[model samples]
Every structure is written in structure tokens, then in C-alpha cells.
Target: MGAGGDAEEGVELEAVREDEPMTDLDMSRACVESCVRFREGTLKSSHVFASVSCPILHKLEEALFCFTANTTEDASILSSKNATPVVLPFLVRFVDFDNKVFLEFHQIMTDRKFRTGKQLCTEGKLEEGLKLMKEAVDINPTKAEFRGHRAYWLQENGQFDEAKKEALTVLIKLNPSYLMAYQVYYNSCLLTGDVRGMQDAILRMKSCPGRVTKSRCKIEENEQILMILKEFCVRLTDLEKTKNFYEILKICKEALKIAPYSNEILVKKGIALFGLKRFAESVEAFKEIPSYSTSFRLLDIMSKAEYLSLKFPPAMEYNRQAIDLLNEAAPERKNLIKFRESMAAISEEIKEVLIAMQNKDWKSMQERAANTKNLINSGSYKNERLKLQMMNFEAGAFVQQKKLDEAFVLVNEVLSAWDTNYEALSILVDINITVGKYHDALTDLERLKGMKKGVDDQMVDRRILEAKTKQQEMKHATEPPTRFLNLYTMLKLPVGATDSEIRSQYRNLSRTYHPDKTRHLSEAEQNDANNRLLKIQTAYGILSDPGRRNNYDKGLAALESRNKTDSKNGLVIRLEENRKKYPKVFGLASSSEEGIPSGSSATPTTAPSPESTVTSKKRVQQEDGVISPDKVKRFKAN
Candidate 1:
């Protein structure tokens, strides 16, 4: 053997020598020397003296070397492999073994590995940290510290069953007094849905000595868990209060991952689905809870889902179940009376809606629907589907009353709120057609056809075709008339009438068709008379002005020239000749009076002579009270 091997073998032999009893200090010094020699590569495992001193000393030397080096990787390997399995017992039997030194060395090695694993965990390398922690527990199976660490890592990694096992081992087998172990156990119980286990852990923690005077790792962990639980509870309560169902559903789903079998979480999920009007989904969520675990709130939600799905019988059955649960509930339960009243009101409203539907009494349906909506707004009811159904019924009542404009407005609101609603769409289509909004009707019909499930396509197509046909007919009927109406035709006058004659004609027509003259007529007739009277007044106003009359005459002359090929042109010529023959009647001024305005009267210089007067009387008598045309001509000649 080499000098180094000789020296290591002699030390092992000296440790086994029974004649010289070593004190605790002597043993500690020897262990420290062995660790230094092992690091210097002088202590070889192959140079074995005996199993008793060699195995224990060899492991202790290696553990102490790793601890003194403070190499996390080497320490982890030593602890994980349980390199000191026999070291404790060997020390206990040794003459100079120091328990304090043994504990210190083990602690140093364990701490190095633990800190490394914890670093890995802090860095979000949970799987690697879990592996390291598991190795730590394997190395020191009797240390609650190592087991508690492993349990925490397991719980964090979502290995609740494994974490619970590790925590139980620490609390039950390794060290029953470890407060951190109880904390880990409680957390595991919470994650694994073991309520009783969590309560037991909490009690043990509270009963722990120095819990208040001394700060403990477990207390910090417990507070962290409490803060998390409180935050979740507050968030859920706020979501429920605000009726934010979608967000509530998401939050509940996350909560379920933490406590998969939690009845409270499942009930909250069911209620959120119900709020979203996902009745079937809500029912499925509710079904996850066992009957024995079901509460009045859960039962009520289930009943509401069935009710909204139009399964009235099942709804009623669920409501009965809820009532039974309520009756069996403790009398001191908060909100018990309020809950019972709400349930009864729901049952009553359901009956009313069903009856109204059965009788097809739209008015009654509307009233019931309105009441249900009010109940929902008042927070007595919480069914969005029911509220939508009530709105549909109210819209239908408007349709039944033939208040189509009102119906249109109401149905539009319903469709805006729930675009996929078939009844609302159908009602909207009907309203559109009734009010001559064919384009809108067609648009709604197309949308309805595209729906996954909706009104009959054939019926809708028929309505579309009818709407198209009516639209075309309306276009044709509303086209402007082909005949042209001139000013003369509008006033019912001859083409060459004088200004005075036009005025006279307008007065007669206006009186005949005046608004007051048609006051006793129907509205339509009164409107028509007013329109005609307005036209007559407008035409008279245009022709009464000289400037406008000249412009109108020019337009009329142009029109006459354009129509010269027709017989109407000959009638126009004859009317012009009659104007020339009766110049005075047509308001034509003579050449001598050209400077005088037409409306001014020409006063006679002297009164009619006595002979002229007697002659006019004789002429009127001779002509049977009518003046002769030759006598009026002779008087003008004289």
C-alpha cells in the first residue's frame, strides 16, 4: 500500500481500538480529519479495515466533505442516495461520537440540497424542483423538513394525491410536531377536496406551542393560503352580485381545478351557466353534485334551467325537490324565508306563463311576461332566458293587436338583444311586411333561412315571393300619369280666356273645392279638395301677375306650336279669334286709351242724355228687359 493508504487504514484501526476510549471532542476531531483526508484523495473506500468503522466513517467523511465544500450538486447526490443511512446508529454506538456534530453535518448537507431545489422552484422549473425535492425526501426519510418541502412542491405541481401522502408521512411518522408539515398537509387536503383533513390540520396548527410568540414558516404559508382563498371568494361573490356570468364561469372553472369535487364551486358554475341561458350546460354542472350534497340554491338553479328549457314538468319536479330541501334545512339558515318566497313566486310565474301559452291569449301572455321581467329586474328571479321569453310574448301581443309600428319597435329591441331568436325574427318579418318595408322583411327572411334552426324555408320563400310581387305592383301603381295638364286644363278654362275670366273661373273652382266646403267629407276627400283648391289658387296667382302671365303665355305658345298637327291647335286658333272680336270683354285697351291701365275705370264726361236714357228704357222694354246689341253699338257711335 502507498503511504496515503497506510495512513487512512491506521486511522480506521485507531477508531476501532477499544482500549483507548475517545471523548465526544476526540470523535468530532477524528471525523473532521477523515473529511479533510477524503477531500485530499487519501481516504479510499477499497482500503477497508472492518465493516463497523469503515462504512459509517466512509459515509460521514464523504457527507462532511460535501457539506464543507458547499457543492449543492454533490450534497444533493449524497442526501438523495441516503449515504448516511447507518451513520446515526454508528455514532450512537461510538465511544466519542458527538450527537451535535452529527446533527450539524446532516443539517449542512440537507440545507445545501434544499436551497438548490428551492431555487429551481423559484425559477418556475417546478418539475426539476419536484424531482430534487423527492430525492431529498428519499435521502432523509425521517426528517419532517425534507418531507414537508417535497409535499409543498408536489402540491404546487398539482400532484395533490402525492403531496397529501408526503405530508401525512411527515405529520404521522417522521415528526408529529412539525408545524410546516401540518401546513403542507392542510394545503394538500384543500387541493384534494379533503375538507375534514384541512380542518384537522388547522386545529393542529392552532394548538401548536409558541404559535403566537414565535414566528413559524407554517404560519406564513397558512396566511398565504388564506389570502388566496379569500381573494377567490371575494372575486366569486362580486361576479355573482354583478351577474357577470361569463366571467363567473371562467373563475369557477379555475376554482374547480383547485377543488374538483367542491360542491360550492360546482353550484356556482351551474348558476353562471344558467345566467348565460345555457340551460342544458347548467343542468349538467348541477348533476355533478351528489343529491346529499345538494343545497337549496343548487336545486333552485336546476329548476330554473329546466323551466327555461321549456321542460315544465321537469322544472316543477326540481322545484319540488328544492322545496323539500328547504324544509329539511336548518331553521336558522340565513335567507331561508326569502328563498322560500322566491321559489314560490317562480312556481307561480311558471304556471301563469304555461297557462297563457296554452290558451294563446296574447294579452294575458304579455301581462305575465311583463310581471316576470319586473321580477327579474327586482332580483327575485335570475333567468335571462325567461326574460327573453317574456319579451317575445309582449312583442307577440303587439302583433295580435295590429299595432304593427309598435310591434316593429318592440321586436327590433328583442332581436337586438338576442339576434338568434326565431320568434323575434318572425315577428319582425311580419311587422315589416305589414308596414310596407318589404326590403327589411326580405333581409330578415334571408337571415332566418341561414340559421341552423329556424322558420320553415318554404313558407318564408312564399312570403318573399309575395313581397316581391307587391313591391313591383306598388311601383307600377305609383308611376306618374302620362297626360300633361296645362294651366288652362288645371283651371277648367278656355285656352284664350282674359285675366278677368281667369280670375272668375278660379273663384268658382276655389269655392267649389275649398277645405271648408269639404269639411263634412271623409279625411281622404277633404285632403283631395284642399289639394285642388291650392292648385286653383296657385294657377290664379301665376296668371294674375303680368310678368308671370307673359312667361306662361310664351310657354303655352311654344306648347301650341309643338302640338300644331293635332285638332287642339284649331280650337286654339278659334279661341284667339273670339278674343279679337270681344276686345273689351277680353280687357283689350283701344289705341286712344293705350296709356291708361286696364284696371282703371274711364269715367264718362257727361251723364247719358235724357233721350239716350229714354231710348235705353224703350229698347229694354222692346227687347223684353234685355239690351239690344245694335242699340249698345249706336250709343257708342253717338
Candidate 2:
């Protein structure tokens, strides 16, 4: 062989000698080194790990680690920049023949990758580290660290279920010896609203302060959850979803024990009492926060309470006050989402009531009564509601009080504003019949019948009877020849007649009347004849005297007016004229006429004070800028 060939064979023989000494530890180390190199390449791709040095620096680092690992100080300083690199020296320290070296090498390789993943995690590069950790878990199933990292990533993304499963798997696989995954599992439980899990986690946290303390809780998070639960309970209470009042009250009482200062609880109590028909107690409960919570609802309920008290003027007064207060309390004009609906409903009811009274509107009244059925059953407006619902009560009251126009005005509002209200129809019925509007009465009655459902048929029949009675009364006032009314009769009989002719005619008529005229005939006949003769004589006198005739004609023209309809306007006019024409005759010729009205009772005829006859619309002068009933009181002073 040549010299060059001999040199090459000598190197090949030395390499074979080196391979002959390779042990099982050396083979395991080779496997670990291969894995570590792959991890380093991944770390370099991940930005989690620093770049590998230039070839010169890399060879220098390897030599330094090999030479200094025996001294702990050099090794510790070397680990400051990169903790994972320390695993290399720990592995290198074991002899090549030692079987423990391979296990140590695997640990160091796993730990280095893990340490790099943690640094990346702190910098918010979670997905990259999570990918590596998942792969590591597959490779090393018993390592809880890999599973813990995956669970943490899921928790960050709000994937609590997956995170919880992973954490549980890590705990199970680690045999409960390693407690690292306990906190992450607890956090997942909390996010899922598992209180029992939270308690267990909290206890574990307390056991190891350092571990548990790292699991941070946002401030007041617990209280916030409690607050949400409280509101949910309150809404349920308001809905009355419980079986009944007692059940709802119990629910409220239980909630109150948890939050005693709850305003919602107090309002709920008031509502419960109202539902139970305890008006006085309900009012007391509602009054608890009149100013605290300004709303039309409180006023509406309060008004209902007062109306149920059965005292009339107070009921009206309270209702008026409630309407006014609601107006003021509303957030906007016409924004009465609830109360306006109520007013609109009640407006129709009032109209039906008045119509029932007028035309004897039975069906309308019954319908109105039905509309108020719930209110009555609950005892909302007991007496006032009952009174308004009576047969023709409101209409009769209006007529008696000489407030016909006001009554009509109110009924008109009910018809035009309220929606197809039977209550309004009933009211109009009673009013029309009472006011002698037979045609109006008839129309409303028919309309009421057409709309009738569950009607009181007896009430309808009664209305028809009352309507006939009203028709008769109106006929008596207008019928041409039923009885002799002074001028009305005299004019009907003859154009002209002198006083003597009238008196002579009267005497002859009296004898012809017989017992009927002078209690010598049937009572009906006597009433009929006496009425005829007296009217004839009065009419003759009115036509005979020129002044009386002229005055009578004027009153006859005014018969369609209010005063002329009830009283004899001609008679009042003559009385007025007589007093003016002959004051002395009317006053009895007083000698000292002091404080006497011209035709008044025989008192003095002079002024008590000149201001007494000031004749202004307002009699009292402005006294200290106050205007009141005191003004009338001043005038009525002795």
C-alpha cells in the first residue's frame, strides 16, 4: 500500500474503535439530543426562544458548559439568560455508562421546551406555546405541565368547558400528586357558574397560598353576580308568577331578608294588599314612598283606595286630586301609556252610565258594570262605583242641581272621546229621557240593545217604563187642551172678550160644570171644568187690557227660553213693572225710609252703606290682594 492509503486506513480503524465503546446510555443520549435539536428548531421558529449563535459562539458555549458545570457558580450564572440550557449540563454531568443519564436527558429536554413556552406565554404569545405544549402532552402523557398549559389557553379564549376537561385530565393523569392543574380547573368552574366547584377551588387555594394567589379575581365580581340575582327575583315578584298573594309575599319576605333595604319589596307588599282588597292598608303601604318615587301609578292606586271608602264628596275629591297629581307626575304630555288607557276606558264607562239613566239604557249600564267588575270584586271604588252605576242617579242629580248643561257636556265627552263605551250610552239614555228628548232616548236604547251581550233584561224593561213615564210628563206640559193655562187657554178659545163678558161667561160656565166644577160632580170632572174656566177668564183679561195684551205677546214669543219654560214670564214682567211704576204702593208708604229696598219688606228705604248697591259684578273690593269666599262673607256681615 502507498503511504496516503495507510494514513486513511489508520483513521478508519480509530473511528471503529470509538463505535465499539458506545453504551446504552450513549444511545439514549443520542435520542434525546435529536429531540432537543428539533425543539430548538421549533423555538427558533416561535420567537419564544432566542436565535442560535454563530458557529463560533455556539462551539464556544458548548465548550464552556462542559468545562464549568462541575462548579455550581459558573453553571448558575450560565442559566440566568436561558434556563433551558442548564438541562444540557445536568445531562452532561452523568457518565456515558450511567442509565440515569438518559432519563435526566429527557427531563432536561422537556423542561427546556417548557421554560421557553412560559417566556412566550408571559409575552402573550399563547397560541404558539399552546401548540408546542399540546404536542408535548401527546409525547409525554404523564406530564401535567403540558395539559395545564393547554387548559390555560382555553380559559383565556373563554372556552371554559374544554379548559375544564383538559385540567381534569391533567389532574387525573398526574395521580393528584402534582397539584399544579388544580387552580386552572377551579377557574374554569367559576367561569361556568359552578359554585360548588368554586368553593372547592377556594379551599385548595387557601391550602397553598402561593398557588391560589396567582389565580386572580376581579374586584366585586361576587357582589355583582348577587345583584343580578336579586333583580331577577324582583321582576318575578312584580309579574305575580307565584301561586297567589301569600306565595308572592313569602317570596318577597325571603328576598328582603337578603336585601332588607329593597324598595322593590315594599312596593310588592303594597300591591299584594291591594290585590287582597284591603284598601286602607294598601293606601298606607303605597304612601310609604310618595315623594321618593314620583309616578302616576301611586296616585292612581291611592285614588282607588279613597273611592272605596264609600264617602261621596271625599271620593270625588280624592279622584280629582289623583287625576291632577297624575298629570303633574307624568314624564310627558299624552305619554300616559297606562293611566291614559285607564282614563279613556273610564270615560266611556261614565258616558254609558249617563245614557242608561237617560234612555233607561240598561244594556249599556250592564256592560259598564261588567267593565268595572274586576274593580268591584277587588273592592277598588266600592261606594262611588256603585252610586255611579245606579239607575239614573247621576243624571237626576245633575238635573236637580240645575246643571243640565254641565251634565250634557260631560256625557258628550264620553261619547266622542271614549271608544264604543256602553257605560256612556247608559248615562246618555237616562239623561235624554229625563230632559224630554224622547227621540234621543229611543235612538240610544236601540243602540244599547244592538250591543248587548250579557245584559240584565229586567233593567231594560224598567227603562222602557221610565221612558213612557217621561213621555207622558212632556206631553202634559205641551198638550194643547188638557187643562186651561191662563193666557195659553184664553188665546186658544177666542180672539177677544171684555171683562164683563168673561165674568158672565164664567158664571154660566160654573153652573154648567155642576158638581164636577163645584164638588157636585165626579172629582175628575170638577178638576177638568175648573181648570177650563179659570184659563178662559185669565186669557180674556190678557187680551182685553191693551198693556196686558202687549206684555203677554212678548212673553209668548219667549216661551222657548229657560225662564219662560218654567215660570210665567209675563207675570214676572208685570210684577217688575208694577214695582217700578208704583214704588210707594209696593213699599207700604214708609215714613222714615232708611235701609229699605224700593219694593222690599217694610224696612227703611235708605242705604245701609252706599257700597251695598255698588252694582259691580264683583261686589267686594280688593282687600289686601286676597280673593276668596271671604269677599262674600264681608258683604253678608250684619
Candidate 3:
């Protein structure tokens, strides 16, 4: 009988009796028929096909879930224990047919929903797409492909936690051999910062019997790197405590061979190098740390390395970050609090000395510089670089106070120890300039150009030109022309002011000259205020752009050279007097080529008659040299 007819009668295969010797085809037909009855809710829980082997019944029990039995009672009924070898081949045949039917049914439904959902996602309807994708996953819960799409969209929707769960619980379980599920899991873990989960995914993928060879290789490489990190990263502290820096360095070298960009190992390497008294190499190692990996230990080690390298500002910042991390982690720890206070005091002293130098508070700068020097010498730091820095600052103070001999001595001493010391070189150059030793200033500038590590080639060239110009000025006793309205002068800033200083000065001047602040003044005063504000805006526009500012500086230098030439020739270049009266001819035109002085009328006083044109040409030719034929013809035509 057909399975549909049997299902209609609610018979649980009682018609197929055990005493009947059934063929393989008959037994296969019986199981599928019984499963169909269970799916339709017509099969009684106590009903069984007695002639079918137990293996056939077991296959039916497994297929019942895929077929979706009507109730849990129906599922439990299909769980049979009786077995016989006679129907085993028939049981395998039955399972293949059932799986084909199940796959064909689910594939059609799942593909339709998945394709439509992906189309919606491509069109940017993410919510609708996600809902349809969920429906597809629900239709085929065992299909890895369907669930992988859902997990990806969830990740795109920023539901990272949900995406991670879907990938780990469903996709990976369904298809552990494929790369797609593991890739989705690893990427989701990255966004959530679940680093350990990411490592787990990579490790699992390393053993996956994946079809993609490239992915498998990459996974194996990553697993090797993880192994190295786990081993070396943990031993860093113990090795450092034991002062076995050579061992630490050896571990770092081996680990770096496997994972060159690993930040943790790099930090440990820097610490080891620091402990080994390799300060320069330690600084190099510390510089490789990415911004995201600036942990407390990295910052603390970097602070010590930089301080020993004689970079005070960077050391201060690094120490401050370490202290801030400590404050956040455990503020009540007595040792940490004491350490924070001590480091903060040292930073404060350095900061005050810098501030004093910037303000040109000579006495205060000298005193603070001395205090910081004493602190460095007496405290744990016995760095010669710090001593050089102090000497450089003291030289700067002395130069500001016009104590040239002492300033020169101090700066020269700093240069003797560290010839490439930028601050000391700057002070020595300034001292040379003050003492009218232009030759020495030029020599210092050449030395600066030779040490090209941090030098801006353009800036060094400009400074060299400036030193030469100053030397020429001193030799000729000729002053630089100060009459022009330069941007620096308009903004009331020094010539070599930094970008931050320019921005700050612009804001202050803008507020000072804003029209709202000048509303109560006279109309003339208001007009002057408007002009000043416009000038301020124009100056800021040119100064804020690096390219434009560089060009403007070149223009200023050219103007200085021109002014010096004029002074040497005893020739005064004056502004035209008739700029407003004769705006086009005498003011804008080249008067020197036209042989027209400032006060002379450029346009003829009256339109010369044709008869007077000839006489005018003669009078012009006799008074001047040769008259242009075009001018005579134009006069005649007029």
C-alpha cells in the first residue's frame, strides 16, 4: 500500500507482519512509509512494523527529526532497540533516499530566501535582509552556508556579540572543516576585542581539514606565532626581575623571527635592552610600539630609556602616562603613590624650567635649571645627557641676559660632549650672532646641516641664508628694512613662531579687533578697527598654510636684498604720488621705462590737436631721449 494510504488509516505498519519474509525493497518501502505516517501525526506511538529490521527502525528514528515528527511522543516511539542483520542493506538504501528528499526540499526554500535576502542587503535594506536571512537559517538550521551569511550580516549590523555566538555555536559546529565559519568567528572576535577568542579560532583553523590551502598555511603560521608569544610574553617579567636580560633578549629575537610586529615582545625587548645598558638600541626598540599597545609597562620602560637617551620631554610624557595608568588601576597603593609623586615632581621641575625659558624670565630660568640639574645629579638619574641639557638651558638664559662669554663657554662645553645637540647648537649660534661673530654662526649652521637626522633641509637652507644676510648687514652697518606690512608684523608674532603660536596669536587678535568690541567707538575708529581685523584675517590665511608661508618668507628675503641694494646705491625707492589721481598710467605702469616722474601727468593735459602732435613729439624728444613712435601716433590720433 502507498504511504499516503497507510498514513490516512493511522496504521503504524501493523499490516507488515514479522512472519512474512520481506524483500529488501519491501523493507525499505516500509520504513519510509512509517516515517511519513509519523510526520503526518497519523502513526500511533505504540505502532511498529514487525517485519522491518531494527536497523531500519533506527534509521527511521534519526530521519524522524529531519522529517519533523508531529510530536515528541511520535519521536520517542521511533526509538527502537530490536535489530537484525537481514535488513541492513535496505536500511542504508532507505537513509540515502530520505536524505535526498530532505536536502532537495530544504535547498529550494533556503536558496530562495538567501538570494532575496542578499539582494536586499546589496540594496542597503539591512533590516529586511537580516530578517529574511534569519528565515533562511531557520529553514535549514544544519546548513553552514545559510548561517554563515546571517552571521556576517549581524556583524555588519554591529551586533558583534550575536554574530560571534551565531558563528561559534552554529556555523563552526555544522562545518568545522571549512574556512568560512572560522573566518567569520575570528573577525567578529577582533571587533569585540576578544583576543583570546580570536586565538582559539586561529588554533582551531590550523587543524581544520580545509580545502583552501592558502588559508591553512596562514593559520599554521599564526599558530606558530601565538605559541611564541605565549612563551616569551609570560617569561618577560621573571627574566627582568632576575636581571637575566641576555636570556630575555634571546627570547625576543626568536619570537620576533616568527612575529615581527608583535608589540608585547617588542616592549619586552626594549626593556631587556634597557637593562643590558644598550640605551640607543633600547630607544629604537621602544619606538616600534604601536599606539594601541602603549601599556603601562611599555610606557614605564620607554620613560627610562628615553631619559637615559637625553630626550627629556618624551621621557616626561611617558612617565606621566605610566603614572596615570597606575592611578587608575590602584590609587591606594603606597609604593605607587610615592613613585607617582616623585616622577611628577621631576616632570614639574623640567616643565617650569622650559616655561621660564620661553617667557625669557632669565633669573627664574637660571634658578629652575639649576634646581633640575641638582635633582637629576642627586637622584637616581646620573645621565650625562641630562647634564648637557641643563647646560644648554643655562646657556640660553645667559644669552638672553647678554652674558656672551659665559653663554659661549657653557654652550661650547655642551657641544663638546654632544656635537649634534640641537638645543646647545641653537644657543651657540645665537651667542655668535650676539657677539657679531657671523663667521662662527655660519660655521655652526654648516655643522647643523651636516647632522641631518632631524633637520628640515628647507629650514636649514633658510637659516643659512638668514645668517649670511645678517653677516652682510653687520659688515655694511645697513639695517634690514622694517617698513613693510609683513604677516608676522601684522599678527604681532616673531618671525620664526611655530604653527601653534600663530594660531593662538590669530585668535587673540581676532577677538581684540572684532567689530562687536568696537561698536562704541567713533565711525573713524570703527573703520580703522575693521581694517585691522581684515589685515588679521589675511595674515592668518597666508601664515596658516605651509606652502604659502614658505613662499611669503622667500618674498620677504627678496625684499630685504632689494632694500640693501637701494641703501648701497644711495637711491630711495619712493611710492608713487599720483596712485589715486592717475590710477592706471603713472601708478600702475612702469614709470622708469616711460620716463615719467611721479608728479608728471601721464595722460596729455588736453587732447593734442593733429597740428600740435608733431610739435609735441619734437618737444618730448628734445626734453627726453627718444620718444616711442606709438606714443606720438596715439597723440596724433587723439
lDDT of 1 by residue, 1-638 (tens): 33345445544433446777665445544654553344356764333222224334445646554444544443346656455643332222232333444445555555656666878988899987777666666666787777887788877877777887888887667766676667667777776556566657766676655554225535556555655655666899987776777778888888777777666778788887766556778889988876523566676667666755645455556766666665545652334345446645754674675577668887787788778777755644454545665676677776786655455556555554455566677777776555444555666677667453333588878988987876565444334334555778789888788988998898899889977788899999998888888778888888888899898889878766655534334333443553454233224222222121121122121234423433332111111111123322332332
lDDT of 3 by residue, 418-499 (tens): 5556666667666544444455567667766745443466776787788798667544544555567778989999889999
Name the lDDT value of residue 354 in candidate 2. Answer: 50
- In order of lDDT, best first, we have 3, 1, 2
Model 1 / residue 325 / CA error / Å: 2.7
Q: Which stretches of model 2 miss by more than 4 angstroms?
A: 1-129, 175-180, 195-638
True-vs-predicted CA distance for residue 78, candidate 2, Å: 36
The positional error of residue 488 in candidate 3, measured at the CA in angstroms, is 63
lDDT of 2 by residue, 1-638 (tens): 32233224432221224547544334333433433443345323223213222222232233334433443445455556343342444333322323332344344445655665666766788876766566556646777777777788767756666787887786565634335466567666654445455555545444543443434432246445455545646565565863356555556566555544345565676676555545566666666543423554665666555444322233344445555655555663234333334433444454555556456654555455455444443442233333333322343345445444444444444344222345546666665554444545655666566454555667866787777775565445544443324464443444345566656765675566545437767778778877776666665666667798778666655643543455434433443554464343334323222122221122221222422322222222211211123422432231
| TM-scores, one per candidate | 0.38, 0.25, 0.37
- Scored by lDDT, model 3 comes in at 0.62
Q: Distance (Å) between predicted and true CA of 410, model 3?
A: 2.4
Model 2 TM-score, 2 decimals: 0.25
Query: Candidate 1, clashing residue pairs?
Result: none
